[model samples]
Structures are given as C-alpha cells and as structure tokens.
Target: MHTCLAFFIIGFLVSTTNGFYSSSDDVIELDSSNFDRLVMQSSDLWFVEFYAPWCGHCQNLAPEWKRVATALKGSVKIGAVDADTHKSLGQQYGISGFPTIKIFGSNKRSPTNYQGGRTADAIVEQALSQLRTIANERLGKRTGGSSGGSSSSGSGEKDTIELTDSNFDSIVIDSEDMWLVEFMAPWCGHCKNLAPEWARAATELKGKVKLGVVDATVHTQLAQRYGVQGFPTIKFFPSGRKDGQAEEYDGGRTSSDIVAWALDKFQANVPAPDVLEITNQAILDDNCAEKQLCIISFLPNILDCQSACRNEHLTMLKNFAENYKRNRWGWLWVEAFRQQKLEDSVGIGGFGYPAQVAINARKGKYVVLKGAFSQMGISSFLKELSAGRLTSPLVPLNGVAEGKLPTIIDSEPWDGQDGTLDIVEDIDLSDINLDDDDSDKMKKVINYRCPKFFQNNFTLSMQSLSVYARLFARAISSTEAEHILFNGLLRLSSSSVHATQSSNSLAITYPSTAIKHAVHLVTVSSGYSSHDNNEYECITKTKRRNSLIEQKPHPSNVYGDDAFFITKHRLGDFLGVADGVGGWREHGIDPSLFSRSLMDACKSLIDNKLIDLNPLTLKELLSKGYKQLLEDKQCIIGSSTACIVALHNEERILHTANLGDSGFVVIRKNTIVHRSQEQQHYFNSPFQLAIHPTIKDPRLIADSPDLASVTSFDVEENDFIVIATDGLWDNLPDATILEEIKQIKVS
Candidate 1:
C-alpha cells in the first residue's frame, strides 16, 4: 500500500508540475528558471500573473486569462507562473497574494500592479492604456503631432492650434479665447519631452481654453516679440485683453498642472452670478432648487429704504457674490413683506429687514445670518459659512422637507427709482446733535468696548459720521438706525480687542494693529471659543516678553517608525507627522532617518519663519521642507509619507497638506466632518516624494510635492483632529478611533 501511494504522488507531481496552464492555451506558462531571461530582459510589453494552482479564484479567472492572452497575441506578451511549485520566484517578486497581475513596461525592475477589473475587456482596455502611456514617453523620437517642434503645422494634435508669426495676432490676440502658447526650438530636448504633455493638456481643455505652439527658431519675429529668451517658453494670453503684457507661465510642466492653471483662469473669467429677486415661484425654483447653497437676502421695502440705500445693499451683495463665485452659490434677494411666506419660512423677520440666510436646498436646511448686515458683517458670515464653522444648526426649510419650496406670490421686479409714499409730509432734524459732543460720545462708546491699547486712538470724526449718515440716509425709524450703527460699532470693537490682546501675547505691536483692521474688514466671522478666551489671559507684559525670548521647544510624539513634530509661533501651531517607508530596510537604509529628517526640517522652517504661515500656503511649506531634505548634507536616501497641518492662530483656520498614506481627520461634535484623502498610485503603493541616491532614478517612485493634497478648514474649540500614519489607520477603524477618543474624554 505504501509503495502504491508513493508511486501515485510521483505521478501527480509529474503530470502538473509546470502549473495549470499548458501549451493548448495561449497563456505562456512560466517557472523559476526562465522568469528573468524571458520577461525581465525582453523588450516587448508583458502582462504577467503569479498564481497558485489550487486557488479557486485562479481557476475561475483561467478562461478570462486565455481570452486576454488571445486578444493581445502580438501587441503584449501574456504569461503566468505557478507560485505554489516555485516559492523562490514568488518570494523574489514579493508576491504575497494569489493570482497577482503585474504590468512590465520599460521599467521591468519595478513593474506596476494591474488594478483593472478581472474581465478580459477591462484587462485589454487597461493594457492598451499602458501601451499609450509608454508610447507617449517615447514620443521624443516621433516626428508627428507638434512633437517635432520644427513647424507650426501638425497632425493628431487638433486641439493644439498651430501659431506662426503670420497668424499669431489674428488667432491669439484678436480672439476672445484665453490662449496658452508654448514657444519652443526644434532641437530642444526639453521641448520634445514636453510635446506629448502639451498635446494632452490641449485635448483635455478643448472647449475651455485654446493651446497653441510656435517654433521659436522658425518664427524668429514672434519669438523676439514675446521676448522668448529660453526654449519652451510658455506665455498665457487672457481673454478680452488686447494690450496688456502676456503673463509668463511659471507653473509645473505636467499635463495636470497645465489643466489646473487653465481652469483657474477660466473660473476667474466667469462672471459673478446675477443677484436676482425672487419675484415668483419660477424664479425661486430656478435659482434655489438645484443649487448646492442658495443665499437669499430679504431687504427692507423700497419705501423704507429708497434707491440709494437699496442699491448700496445690492452692491455689497454683488461684491460678495463676485468674491465667492468659485463656490457657484445662487445669490437672490427678496423685499421684506413682498415674500412674506419665504421670509417666515426662513425665520428672517425675527432678525428684521435686510436679513440673510444660506440654505442648502438639497438638504432642506438653512443657517440664518447671525452677524451684522454691513460689508464687515456679511463678509464674516460668508467666511464662516465657507469654513463650515457656523455654530447655528441648519434648520429645515418650511415645506422644503416635504420636497416643496415656500409658496411665492408673483410680483414686479424693483424699479431703479425710489418708491414714493402716499403722505408726502416733510420732517426736519434741526434739533438732532451732529456736533463735536456727539462725536466724543461715539468715541467714548467705542473706546469702552475696545482694548486699552486702542483706547487713546479711538476717535470718531464728524466727517466720518457724516459719510456714514449719507450712505445709510433712509426713511427708517431712529430706533432701527441706531440699532444698525450700534451693532456695527460693537462688532468692530470686539475684533479690535481680540487682535490687540493676541498681538500683545505674541509681542507683535505693529502686526497687531494691522491684524485688527484686517480682522474688522475681512473678518473670520466667528466668535471666540473657550480656548481663545483662555489664550487672551496670557497677554500680560511679562509673559509677552518671555514669549518673545528664544527658547528651544520639545519635539512631538512618535510611534514606531513614524515621527511627529509640533511648534508654536506668532501665527499659530505647526503640527506634522511623517511615516517612514520600511521597504528601504531591504536596501540597508534606515527608514526612520528619512521621516525624522523630514519632520525636523519642517520644524526648522517653522522655528526660523522661513515659510509664511497661511491657510493656502501649506503646499509651499511642504515644498520648502522637501527641498531642505534634498539639500541636506547627510543625504537622506529613503522615502516617507508626510502630513502637515498649520493652524493660523488668530483666524483659527487649519491649513493642511498631505502626501502619501499618512493623514489627518477633523472631528467636530464627535462627528468626522473633514479628513485628508490618502494619495496612492495603486493598492498599498502610496504616492510619495522620495530621495534616491541617483536623482530621477526610474526604479524609485518620486512624486512631486505639488501633488500633495492641500486644503484648509475653520476649526473651533473641542474639535479633535487625529493625525496618524497608515499603521494606526489600517489597524483601527474610524468607529474604534472615535470610541477611543470618547473614552479618553470620559476618563
């Protein structure tokens, strides 16, 4: 019996030792011996799969595999390996999972994993896409589609217009379309390399902006006209401008970079949304129903405030609408009492006329404006709304929860002229005080509300008061007028107080005054949190001087191979975390050195104030930090995933930039409202900026810092932000993290 079993096992091994695939199928069966010589060294493109013979998924995918192999018979080589029989080959390629497919392009040493669908159609589509990418990379040798850079004429790049000296003015200057023109020399290698990317960008921006190219060597006149000092000189000609200097394109040369820059220009060219009056149901439906956020203001009746006052309000709204045009919010207005149902539905009357509310029409929720109605007030309100920091709950719109807008009564649009009253009786204000004493009283009121630093300078001139009266001269009651002016003064005074106190704490006298005016003008539009209130108490003279003195700060927390750093300055706190890539261990490099070096470089930037701390400048900070890492004398030779968050102290806004799998999540009221998205090229392979021994090495994955995901958010006290690496995130789910936070708070 033992002899019979041994013979049966030997027969089974002899039968299927080379794996499931055979000569009958189109699939090229591979083993440990021929992997390097056949696929690695081959010049042709290859799609290879490492599979286990006993795997059910491999068996299920066998038919589709054969179909894919048949489809790309000559174009791409399809092959398979049995990992169960050849463990060395599987270990060599780091194939931990069964039926893993990899695409071998020009860089066979670092083959990319195939992430397309399992079906033959999806595989073929992805295979062709890869082939096109490889072809585009080798486009330097090709002579078609503007790649040659020898003439203005080209095939295959229809979207990319051919611009020469003869037609440059007629097509580029005269036309209303925004044009991005590239001036290149025929023999320039950089121009050749940028050809495919330029063509791709042109194709993507087909209907939006026109992209053109000129051979600087051929069109010497046009080149000198634009002062093309270098090859591949890029110039941007904006729409509707015939004379002004063409702006130099200093942005990245990648296709995505070009598209992003063009899109920004396109959006800037778009006119602000028309501030329409909701006169009827159709108008309301057209403006509000489909919008992400609808901003509706109920101004006082024309009789209450004449054309001058109404127009002033409308102009303010228009300016805000223009500033926030990128959000694509619908801006509409309605006269109070004209749209009684709409006003009541949004609870606008309780606040008084000239009230405003931002409604999320899709969610049937609205947030009433809590700040003043002037430029400062409205600006603050909108900023708060934009930051998602408005504390007011989104009250459900009346009847909107039932999928219906409030009933609107048909009415005529406002006429440019002021409405006349039935009783045309005139009144005189001869007894009212418009003298120095009144101005002094106003100054006293402002001084009382403002801090001691601004008390001496808090003076209200009669001319300023006269201007204010002229702007707001309306046929309204004295009580209402006083209410408006008093509210504005209080708001301005409160901001001044906050700014002075904050500046004192940081020992910044000059900047505090500027911050005060800026805060009052372009307000962050949120009240002080408990944390802010506590910080204000630290504004004593001794403490201020102490804070100004240089002192070494402690480093932030670290876990395993990850390093974190936090530093505070006059602007705000800089918090950052970097996760070292462990794969460098195989190459005899310490991964922790890379991440720690990166975090330390970032801390140095913050400490030395090498980079400006702003909500939108986090990407710049990352760029500077990454550059510092590259310029380090020690020569860090590993990769890391990074996440940095900058808190603009006074504004209470969090500016963040994340690269790779390390990320941060913002929890407001115990609910995650915002989080950083992981940047990954493929599954488990994150998008990282690397420093290899050889610069621009094809074997290493080195993404640009520009590709880091940069974003900003307004934060309040009690908002917990968890910044961590993939280790913590992969091991713990969001629910578990939140629960742990709750437990920590409870304890």
Candidate 2:
C-alpha cells in the first residue's frame, strides 16, 4: 500500500529542531495549508515523509532528510509532514509509526512505498532510477509505431509490432489479439534496458498475444489520453472492450515473466453467455486499453448443469452482464487454476467463491468489494470509484490560518510610580449639603441601561452621551463633564440640586481615584427653558464613579522571550500587555490579534460587570473574552503569551492568571513574595491557544483551564508587583529577576 500521506505545512521556518538543519538541506515543509497546490496537482514526482515531532527516530533523521531534499530538490519534490499535528493524514494512510515515507508519481492518486535505505544518497539514487525508467517507457513508444502488425511464429521477427498514432486504433484498439502495448520513450534508459526482454517475450507469445510499443514522446495525444507518466509504461487491451478501455501492465520485467503474463491474460476467460463476446476484436485487443477500470469475477464451477446454486449464480451474472453492457464493461469468470497467475497478480489469495475486484490496468491498482455481492453493493462500490471518492491523493486547500501563539501586544514596561497613587474613595456624606426646606428641591434616582455596541470612543460625540462616562454619559451630556474618560468606564453617578431650574452649567467631576479630584467640567443645557431657570436655581454636579488604573511595571521580566506582561490596569487590576507568539511572522500574519482583541473585549466585560476584578472573575474574563475572539468573524489567527494581574481589594488579594510564558512576582519588605510558573512545548514552543484551522490541540485555548495558570495571594501597600513576558525569563533566570526587583524595592 503506497499511500503518500502528509500535511503540506506552508509558511514555516525552523529556528531549530531541538537543533537546526544544515544549509545544504532544501526540504520543502508541508502542512494542511498547502498540500494541494504543491503536491496533489504537481506534475513532478514527490516523496514525502510522515513524521512526528516527538519521535526520537524522526529527530535523528532530521538532518539526513534535509540532505536528501537538497540532493533531489529539482528532480524530485521532497517534503515532510508532522504526523503528530496532522493526525488525519496519518489515519488515512494507516501510519502506525513515525518517519514513514511514500512516493507519489505524477498521477498522485497512485503512490508507491519507498523501502530503500534511509541515507540521503540512497534516497536520491532511488528517485533517479525511477525517473530513468519513466523516460524509457516514453521513448520506446514514439519510434516503434511504424511496425504495427501481427506476429505469430515462435519466431522473433513476426512477434513485436511498432504501433503509431495512425495505426494504434486499428491494430490495438480494434484487433482480436490481446494487445500488450508498452508506451515508451527512446531517450529513457529504462526503456533501453527492457527492449531486448520485451522483444523476446513478443516472439515467444507470437499469435496468442500481440506485443507492441508506442513512442509516447512522439505521440503525445495517445500517451497523455492514457496517462503515461513514465517510460516503458505497459498497458494491456482485452478483447470486446471500448475505445477508451485500457489497463496498465505492472508486472515483472523479465522476458519469461512478460511471456507468462501475456499467456495468462490471453487465456484468462470468464464463462459469459457468449464466447464470441470475450473473443471480439475490441475485447481481445482494446478492452481496458484506455486506463478505464474493469471488474472481473471468480466463481465456483459446476461439473454438471444440476447444481441449483450454481444455476442461480450464473443467472445473476448473466443479468449483470446485460445491465452493464451500456457501461462497456465486461463481467467474466475463470475456473480455478485456469488463470492462476493473473489471479495472483490481483491478490486473489484466501478468498471464498464469487469474489469480484475492480482493477485499473492504467495504474495496475484494484479494489475488492467488502460488501454483499448484490446489485446494491457492487453498484455502490463502482459509483464511489468513478467519482474518485475512494481514491484521495489530492485535497482542496481551505483558506484560513489557525494558530495558538499571538503577536506581541502593543505595550511598554511600567515605570515605577512614586509619591501618590490613585485610590477610589467611597462617597462621603459630610461634604454635601442638601436644601431640605427649599420649595423646588428634588431628590430622585434614575436607573440607566448601557447602550448596545457602545463605541467606547473617549468622546460621546457619536450620540448624546459623554465619551468618558460610557453608559453614564446617557444620563448626562458630554459638555457637562467635558473630562476625557479612560477606557472601560461604563457607569456614572451624579448628585445635583437645581437652585434655579433654568438652563445652567452643570459642574461635573469625572471620577478618578483621589489623585484626579481636581479634574472637573461644567456645561450649560438648552433642554431646560430660561423661563424656568429663575423658578429655582439648580446646582447640578456629577462625580467620578470607578477607578481603573493602567500600568505594568515590567513587560518581560518573568515570562519567556516571547511572553507579554501587563501589570496595573484601568479596571480592578493592574495594566496588561501581550507579547504575541512569534510563529506567525514568517507567514506575514499579525500574531497580536488574539491578545489585543481579547484585551479589548475584556474592557467591555468590566464595564458591563460581566466579570469582576477578582482572580476567578479575571479567569472568566480572560477565558470568555479569548474564546469569544476565537469565534469572531473578524478573528485572531494565532495565540499570545498573556499575563494579567487583578487586585481583589475586597479580599485584599492580588489575583494573577499567566498563560504561556508570561508571569509575575509579588514583592514584600524588599523580598520576593510570590511568583508564577512558565508553560512550554518542544524546545521553546509555549502552550497557547491557536485558532482551530492552525492547530489541533484543544487544551491550548483559553476555554481550557489548564491553558492558563492562575494564582491568588495577599498583598500590602507599596508592594512592588513585577510582571514580565518570556523575553526577560528566557534570558534572565528567576534569581536574576528577583535580585533586580529587590534592588529597585530597596532604592
């Protein structure tokens, strides 16, 4: 079973295979992404390796395979499939082990097993040998066409016929003799090797079988119409066959072997209702002559006409013969030992009575029906074969790249903050004075709903809301606060008493943790009539609501070289930055989409209160947002090294979720407090979410808990939280990261 199976991986460049390949090696890497255009429809021959990344043998051969590829780059298409990642290709070919190699000829649909030595020189040699054989088959056909005729006389002169385009149809397609025509090319070395043997076999078979050759190089039409890819390509034409019916001859090359093969084919008979039908000119010379596949059956023979089962079976075959006549296909049965050589050629060993197989003489390939020997079963099998459904050498390419690693998020490391920090203060009643005795004083509570698809642009200029107030803007005007709001501020609160109910500037203070207390704005509104202004002076004032700080002390001090880290954020936690996977760079893809998109969605989750700023909520936020991005129509293709820190003030704990190689460390009393663990795959490949089309592992997605490592612990004031991506970790060990942090803390 020579089934060439591999995923053509496009856009891949190796940094090292736990090591690197030599520069002399020139193997094309294949994956699911580009197998069709590069391998299936290819005119060149391809020898592909199905290997696993974790296999020690494959790892060992990595360098040698590269050498093989470099040696045969132009003449033979060579590549490798990572079977570990492409399990479908492996299953289709039944690859139970790694480093399995198969060769695909021009027809791709037909593949041959490669059992030669594993050395680079050996692989190259084998490929070259096959190429020479292919060339010879074509040359023999082009120059031998003029001698097309009958030859019978155990004599050598009258045996072999030189068939040409003009006489091929009359002598081979329309003759009674079983035609064994070899499509050859004169320039091919393999054709030269088989010429003497073929001539001898032609003489020995004489009248029983007509041996002929066609120079495929000169007669391109017949050669192409019959799919002649290699030199010395042999095909057989059976009697009572259609113009396009031909079977390729795949057998031993010796003259005696050729004579024996033709004898069996010439004598091979199925007891059809009519003897003349099997002996017809078309049947004897042209049947299965055009690469068309034919099915033949082997059934039990009855000595007398008294066997009831035999009679019924004969009746069934007769009916089939009648029904399939329009198909121009023949159904014949040969008694046991009558065509033993031919039967063995098609693998008829260990079979019971009434066995049938469809064989393609063009490729010398066949498929046996495993189903019932009935109309429904046989018809179904033929239908599948005709549609090319059963034979899959070429597959279509679906455009969409999926991967788990992300491009680094756009970010900068946090500069240590000093002196004062923004802190949210509970609303104080002592500062406010309400006129209880005023005749027009009004106390009211208004519930507001956030608008769907809030652009979240800093200014509420899209509609009537404040850009900074978010949904709170709906309750007030942007001109009222006039303060630029940070990202993710959804709800807003305002407390105001109108001293005069007429149009007036409403003094508003967009909430900022204590530090931004002085930031305030005022606006005059025409919604209220001037006539009502003097009725009661209105003192309208709005205050800032929630605090979301944005800052990350260090981006790559803890995680891997490609890890992304964000420390203090505007929401309930610290800032965030994602250093996306670098893998997508070779493909011209932005790996940062996963992290940037997810982080952007996280802001919405915070504003909607869809998630809290606690450790668990952060996990939910990260996982849900990331998965949602994965499902987005405008989706992210790769994964990222992500790290986000959430401070659960209520629990007085700092919650951290580290995915890939991004991580953090908490410091107290100028000493290390807590740290995160790094996750990785072979060598430096970190475990992360890859879009489905790009990767097969489900655990790498955010929806899987194991994909992200989480931690929760206590924290105190002035504690330095150092977070970083893999860039810092890969270069600086843990002790180095902590040692530097200790110095910064002490300073």
Q: Which numbered prediction scores highest in lDDT against the true structure?
A: 1
Q: Write the per-residue lDDT of candidate 2 for residues 1-747, one digit (tens) a residue.
A: 223222222213233442323334587777678877888888787888888765655766777888877777788888887776778877776675557786776446655556567788888887886666556555553223223222222345456787888888888777766788888877776676666667777877776777887888888888988999987798988866547688878656745456655665654432233311122224422444342556666543222111454456557767765544434454544432234444565555322334566655545455665555566766666555543444322211122122111111222221222112112222222232433332111111111222222223213222122221222222333432222221111112121112122121222212212123211111111111112222122111100000101222122211111212222234444434355564543333434444445555555555565434655766676777676766762334556666666654344566777776666666566556677766654224555655543434434443253468878887665465655554333333233333333433121
* Per-residue lDDT of 544 in model 1: 33
Lowest summed lDDT over 10 consecutive residues: which window, candidate 1? Answer: 520-529
- lDDT measured at residue 419 in model 2 versus the true structure, 0 to 100: 15
Give lDDT for model 2.
0.50
Deviating ranges (above 4 Å) for candidate 2: 1-571, 610-614, 633-635, 692-706, 733-736, 743-747
Best by TM-score: 1
Question: Could you tell me the lDDT of residue 478 within candidate 2?
Answer: 46
| Model 1 local distance difference test score | 0.66
Q: Where does model 1 exceed 4 Å of error?
A: 1-146, 149-156, 401-404, 423-747
Assess each prediction's global lDDT (C-alpha) against the native: 0.66, 0.50
